[model samples]
Target: MPTPNPAALDFLQTRRSRPAKTLCAPVPDRATLEMLLTTAARTPDHGKLEPWRFIVLGKGAMPRLAKIAEERGQALDLEAEQIAKGRAQFDQGHLAVAVIEVQRPSPKIPALEQTYSAGAVCLALLNAALAAGWGANWLSGWPSHDRGFMQAALGLEDHERIAGLIHIGTETSAPPERPRPDISTITEWVET
Candidate 1:
């Protein structure tokens, strides 16, 4: 007989994502973080190509990533605030995992599929952290889209790119619930 997991269902129904900027210190330890990474790795990958990877940037790597983000932002002529926002995830982060979308050359599996899989991994990581009693958020600012930043910060290869940065830590304050889309209006029924 299988045991019921009502808590899991309940949590899913009410789970909300805390903003990365609002997250603070006391991040999850290495062993605990590994659990979240393990959960994230289970994302759906078409043809088992596994066209994605993750870079766990703990406390030690934040300064380096921040420095690179600032430099890249300056080169792009971004405003001071814009540059700061790009580097905020690292500058104030306790822990983060960068989801990298790797496009593999495959005749069967399409590149879009790989991209979707990487996005799934990001969500998985965020949900896993929340489930583990840690506040988490998925963030992607200009740094995530900047090629120079990706190459320098995360050491991305030509075929790989940033999908998202999952920031996990304690919530400094509770996030107010925002309005959600009307599901009925968005859903379409298929009938012959």
Candidate 2:
């Protein structure tokens, strides 16, 4: 026999990411955000490497990051529309958490595993925020992938990279449920 948490399972089944652009004000306070971060930190860490960290971006920091994104986009010779898209997330963000993947040297755990762990943290944080009744979305765009932007905007080291940027705020309107993947086609059964 196995113990079950129906509520948790139900929540997982119903979970859907809110669009970042649709997220508005009344973002979680520092205390509340801290609780969510703590929950996110509980994600599984192979070999106990804990190769991830969070950088909370408050509303006041949005403009600076947005500007950096614009500059980085231009420096990379990106199109005007691409530059706008690169900066849009920061321009419209109220609050966001940057989940950074920090690679630690380990003979036991591979770098890919560390990356997977970091991604897991991002999902955990997003889920934590949603479970707490906040509109949340995990995003990553050109800015996140640009080393120049990462250096100028976030001051990340060479070994650190953005796993995700999770935006959290009040929901202005409920999002329509999107189509889900067909699980049967993706699943496999193995027996020996």
Q: Which candidate tops lDDT?
A: 2
What's model 1's lDDT at 191? 100
Candidate 1 on 1-192: residue-level lDDT in tens?
A: 998899988988889999888888899988998888899899888899998888989889999999999999999999999998888788989888999999999999989998999999999899999999899999998999999999888889989999999999999888888898899999999998
Query: Distance from true position, residue 190, model 2, in Å?
Result: 0.9
Question: For every model shown, what is its TM-score relative to the native structure?
Answer: 0.94, 0.99
Q: Per-model C-alpha lDDT, please?
A: 0.91, 0.97
Q: Where's the lowest-lDDT run of ten residues in candidate 1? A: 86-95
Stretches of candidate 1 exceeding 4 Å from the true structure: 1-5
Q: List the residue pairs that clash in candidate 2.
A: none
Candidate 1 lDDT for residue 69: 93
Model 2 spans with C-alpha error above 4 angstroms: none
**Once model 1 is optimally superposed onto the true structure by TM-score, how far is the C-alpha of residue 51 displaced, in angstroms?**
1.2
TM-score of 1: 0.94
Weakest lDDT window of 10 consecutive positions for candidate 2: 171-180
